[model samples]
Each structure stands twice: as C-alpha cells, then as structure tokens.
Target: MSQNVTFDDRDQSVLNYSPGWFLTGTYNATSVGQTGTLASSSITNVNVTFVFPTPATEFFYFGIKRCCGGSYLICIDCDPNDRKFITIDAVDPTDDGQSPPVVLFSQKFSVAGVHEVILMNQPDPAFGGNSQITLDRFELTVPDPNAVQPTSATSANLFSTPTPSSTAGPELVGSASSSSSNLAPILGGVLGGLVILLIIVGIWLLVRRRSRRTLYSEEQATAPGPQFQSQWRPNSTFTTLTTPGTTISTTTSRRELDAGRIYSTYTESADDPLPPEYGQVFNTAGPSESSSLEPPPPPLPLKASR
Candidate 1:
C-alpha cells in the first residue's frame, strides 16, 4: 500500500481533519509565496498525528525543504505502548536540486496503531528572524512479501570447497619425484668423480712404492760386504811384497781408506815344514838310507884324510 500526503495552502479542511490525521502548531497556512511551483508555509513547533488502518510494516519517507535556519528537529513516535522514538536533524541543502526525500523510519509493526510525528524549528541566533520548517510531501510504502531476499551462501560455498586442493597433493608428490629424478645425475657424477680420485691416488701410491723399492735394491747391490768393510781404518799404510826382492808401498789417506776396500799381508818362515805329500815325493827321487846306518866309517876316513 502506498500513500502520498501533501499540504496545499488552499485546503483549509486539511488542518481540521481529526478522524485519521490532524495538525496543531503556530504556522502561516499561506504566508510565503509559491516556492518551487508549489504552495509553501513556515511552521514552528508543529505536531502531526497519523492513524494507520493496520500496523505500519513498511517504510516512511518525509520530504522537507528547510530555509535559512539553524536546524530542524524531527521525531517519529511509531509505537505508543513500546514507545520507540527516532529523532533526526534535517539541515538545509546547499541548493534546491541537491535535496531529496529522506526515509524517516523503517520498521515492522506488531499491531494496528497510531504514530505521531513532531517537528520543531530552531532559530539561527545570528540571523534572529522567524525560524520555520517547510514540508513538501510524505510517502508511506509497503514492500512485497513474496520477493526473494539475496544472500551470500552460494558465494561462501565457492571458497569452502576443496576441489583445487585435491589435485594439489598429487602435484606435490609428482614434484618430489621429479626432484629426486633430477638429482640422480648429480649424485652419480659426484660418486664417479670420487671413484676416479681414489683410483688416481692408488696409482700414485703404487708408483711411489715401486720407486722406493727400486732405489733400495740398487743401494743393496752396490753396498760393501763384511770382508771389504773390515779393511777400512782412520789411519793406515799398506806395503805389498810382490816377490822376495820386490816391494810395493801404498800410502792411504783417511778419506781414501774409508772407501771400504780389502788388504792382505804375506809372511814366509824358514823352519816351516813341508806337507807329508811333498816329503814323499822328495824321498821317492833321492836315496832312502838313514844317516845312522853307515855314518861311523865315513866319519873316520874323513878325519884321517884331513
């Protein structure tokens, strides 16, 4: 249901209508000239009463045009038993084209009742003239009950679903497998390098050991034996007899004798006996008669002849 209530200066019956609505205040019914192609008036402390057929379950829009004043105070007493009051201040617009109707109150009613609307004007202290409130129109509207109310449930469910995350798990697993696959060549390369390094180190160690063994063998082969080492001395002189009549003298320095050479000395004795084999050969060549056999006769004859 919709209703538009307008106040015209020519309608004096609108001021005294008490069956459903009435107005009481100090107001000039037709004082100001026509404002914006409609009759306008100045009102102060005006109280307007409205009786609805049933409870007001919709919204009320009030159109007010305020002139030069301090401020306008408007109050709506929607329920007298519960008595919930809504107060609003209406200020003059900067220009006429910028002004629009304002919704005074929107509520659902419990029972059919009467609502009171009170308007009061405050004078501008600086201007010090008569303060007034101009009313253009009032509209009451009831909305359709069967109209669907919009909600965010469908939009909220779009974010709450886990469809994208179901595929994310497999993607992460595949990434891990791919990462392992990529690292295989790198690990193999590092291991191969380490094996090559170990082989080179082994070859180097074998070569070093063989070289050391070869050096030790050469030293052992060239080294002096015990017999040659016994000849070395700090100070020594050597004389070699080649024959009975020849002699060779060798003077050895300390540095030269330290070379670890061999030296030998030979000596001959006159009383030294020959072996038995040499005696038997000499006896075989000469006579076997002993000196004691025929020695007396020979000794007497030799003395007589002397």
Candidate 2:
C-alpha cells in the first residue's frame, strides 16, 4: 500500500521528504552542495538507497557530506533489517560553514573492515515527516595505529572517531583484516536487537494508548490562565564546551513556566555534536520548534580542526 502523493515542500516541523536512488556517488560541500544531485519522488513507500566501498580499519564514519535538505536512515550492512531507523535530518537552512553532516551515525564493531553501509529514505511512517532523503558524501575514520583499539562498547564511539583536518589513515600493513572476516558476530547482533525491539514495542503500545487518552487533558493543563501566566523570561545563554579535541557551541533557552518554575530547553542546532533521536520533544514554542527539526543535513565529510 502507498500514499501516491507527489511533489510536497514541507516545513521542518512536519517532516515529509522526496525520493532518491541507489546511486553510488560522492559530494563535497563548499558551503552546502555545489556538485551533487538530489532525488525527488512521489511514492510514500520507497527508499532512496546509496552504497560505496570502504577500506577496512578500526574506525569509520558514514555521514552525508552535503548540507541541503532531506532526512535519511543510515544502517551498517543489514543491521535490524531496517524495521526501525534512526533518522538524521539534513534540512539545515544555514550556510555559515558551522554545520554539515547534520547527524553522525558512528558505530564500533568487534572488528573493523568487516561491515558495510546502507542508507535509505526513512521507512517509519510514525516519523511523520517527508519521505525524501539525500547523501552527497561520506566521511570515514581510518584507525590510528599508535592508539590501542577500544574493546568495550561503552568506550565513546560517537565523536571519538573524528580526526583532525591533517589526519590520514595508517599505511597498509597486510591483508590480515580480510583473512579473519566473519559474519557470526554481526548476525548475532541483529538477532539480539530484534529481541529488544519486541520488548520495547510491547511497552510502547501500552504507553501509547495511555498517552492518547490523556493527550487532551495534558494540553489543557499546560495552558495557563491570565493570572498564572508569567511574562518574565530569563535571558537565553550561549556556551561553548570542549571535550578531548572537539568543541561544541550551544544555545539554551531558559524560560519561566506558568508556575514560576524555570526550565532550560535544548534542541538540535549548529555546533551540537549529535542529533536528537526522532520523537523526543520538549515544551517547544515559537522559534525553538522550527530550529530543532532542520539543523543542517547529515552524512557530510566531517571536517575537524585541532
């Protein structure tokens, strides 16, 4: 079954993307894409997939290099069978060179050079956004021979993979990585993931029914009467945080709710290292709502400065 809808230009809030292809391609964003192509489709149940070969190493990053408009679901080899996708929004409207590769999906394997990347248009209808996605470029992090490989999954695999602008992969030693290639580990992982997903779905459905019943009541409670409304808003603040070698600059909105309770709101924005998981929401209003959903495109050549 398909919606058969065509040619929709949706705002960041209500996500709905066009369609692309399984083309093998690459892109370099000067300040947004200059030499790349975009895919537009009219079907609601299709995926625009892209594939490329990556050399074996201890670490690698797969991101959309172009900073344009689209949302995509990135996966390693065939993890979880695409039943659920972690989407990265590539709808950044800013060209300040501060944002690209909107969201980064970095995963550490039991062994390197043993997996592949498959990107597709978001398949979850619950995402409630456009169905289109794009991939202009991919960034990879070849392992550093001088550093010991991380063995534990807890070891930060996220931003821990970014390299300085002058970084390069270690010289090829041998074909040992290829000789030891095995699928047992990845296959086991996929099975375990499916089990966990079933548990989550059961819990989620129970919660979903409750949430719907209380949805109207919660909305009604959030509205404050004239007497309870507070006109005073705390000054929004900007802060820059540095971890290891990466610097994250963030802006937070502190607002006084109706009962004089102050809460800080955080959303996806430029300078943030990671994108939020879809469906997570805060008490967003006015400017914050729009900014969170459209923070640059994901899957870019991550340029890190030392």
The positional error of residue 172 in candidate 1, measured at the CA in angstroms, is 40
For each candidate, the alpha-carbon lDDT, in order, equals 0.46, 0.47
Off by over 4 Å in 1: 1-40, 78-87, 96-114, 120-130, 143-306
Candidate 2 global Cα RMSD: 61.2
lDDT per residue (tens digit) for residues 1-306 in model 2: 111111111221222223434344434457654544333332344553323234334322334422343565655566555555656555444444333343245555453354555555543343455444543334444445556556643376543654444444442222225434556677788999999999999999999999997997998899977776675546755557667867888655644443222223556688867766443443333433432333234333334355
Clashes in model 1: which pairs?
none
Top TM-score hit: 1
Q: Candidate 2 lDDT (Cα, whole model)?
A: 0.47
TM-score of each: 0.29, 0.28
Off by over 4 Å in 2: 1-55, 58-69, 79-82, 93-103, 123-128, 142-306
Given candidate 1, what's the lDDT at residue 150? 39
